[model samples]
Target: MVHRMRLMMRIGRSFVSILFTAMLASPAIAQTYTVQAGDSLWKIAEKTKAHDVTVHQMIAAIHENNSALLGADIGNIKPGMELAIPSQTAASNASSKHATQLLSGTGSPFSTPTRNTRIDSIQKKISHIENEIEDTIEALTTSQDSFDAMVTP
Candidate 1:
């Protein structure tokens, strides 16, 4: 009886160890998200809370996982469309791989302008508009002068 008990204990320990290992080895199951009105990929990614990945990475993972449903246009998601939210580990892996590509100067799916860049862009546009206004005033003055000369004669 003593020998049998020890053997059974050993078997139980082995079984527990195997179960734990299998659980860790398996990938996390993905959850499904239903698209809502006014929901964009960016908004969905932001609200999903996938840890260890940026919103861009989450967006890319979502697009990759749901390519069949999303098709070529990521922006065309409509209300009631279901999306598989990638597992946290999957998103982390995808984002890490994508981050390397992005850091190496590869293109990103989205671009966010820095404050300075936006300010400079606005300044340039303002300068161009001012130049256009000045040219218009000069043209109008020239026309008026021509009219005055003709009327005086």
Candidate 2:
């Protein structure tokens, strides 16, 4: 009976350890947000609390997540709208579980050299992604136009 008790305790400990490990290792979850009248992207971003990606970083994510809000400018998003938010987990995971989230765009005017460097790097990435999106949009528009031509004639 003592041996069985010891084995049960050990099993319990192992299960607890596994549960803690899983909690630590889980990916950030995604969330959905709605825009309110007078609501801004910056405000919504403030709520998301993602580290590496800013509210702006999510313009792409927003469009991808909420198919209904397409073509709306991220910078000038209106209120009374709903948006998809990235789980803090996914954002953290995207940065490889160790990546620090980006400093908020509203950081102090006294920016450090490191901040400048990071901004440059992020801007480059954003530019690349924007170019890709534009190319895709162009391709899709072209296809649509061609199809329209084909169907009309």
Candidate 3:
């Protein structure tokens, strides 16, 4: 029963993979965005129709060009303001990826790759130390038993 279930899943996955690959590889679909008045950063992001969250980066870029817009007042967005929507290309994807990576407590986003490497290294060291400790305690117990036996005799 489980074997059949696994087989079905594999077939379904391959079918979907081929379908989507053919879809994306074909002509690119053009997306359109209309600017409306009084739209806030959060509002624009919510409307972008992108699968991934891109509102924060869009808001960041908007503010970069116009620093005066960064005030705490969220009620002041003018109507019909033109804001450029960012593409989810490799450049923008990095920011989103980094943002997500941060939420899981792996490490700093911009840290040297060495930091990530060291985390794995530390984990390996901890596992090795635990194994060594277990072995040492077993050895100590055997030696203690032998000493007790000798003393008793």
Which candidate should be chosen as best, given TM-score against the real structure?
1
Please give, for residues 1-153, the per-residue lDDT of candidate 3 as tens digits: 999999999999999999999998998554434456445444555576256536545444333333354333323345665444555552244354443332232454322323433354476689999999999999999999999999995
Tens-digit lDDT track of model 1 for 1-153: 999999999999999999999999997776999999767666687788466678768866887788799765566578999999988767765664553332232465434433433454477689999999999999999999999999995
Give the lowest summed-lDDT range of ten residues in model 3.
Answer: 109-118
The TM-score, computed over Cα atoms with residue i paired to residue i, of candidate 3 is 0.30
**Per-residue accuracy of model 2 over 35-128 as CA lDDT, tens digit each:** 7755444455556756666544453344445535633333434566667776654444343211122233233332222433355458768999
Residue runs of model 3 more than 4 Å from their true location after superposition:
1-18, 49-54, 61-84, 88-153
How high is the CA lDDT of each candidate model?
0.72, 0.56, 0.53
TM-scores, one per candidate: 0.49, 0.39, 0.30
TM-score of 2: 0.39
RMSD of 3: 15.7
In candidate 3, how many clashes are counted? 4
Question: Could you tell me how far off, in angstroms, the CA of residue 103 lies in candidate 3 after the best superposition?
Answer: 22
The reply for model 2, stretches above 4 Å from the true place, is 1-5, 17-30, 51-60, 92-153
Cα distance off (Å), candidate 1, residue 2: 19
Candidate 2: 10-residue stretch with minimal lDDT: 96-105
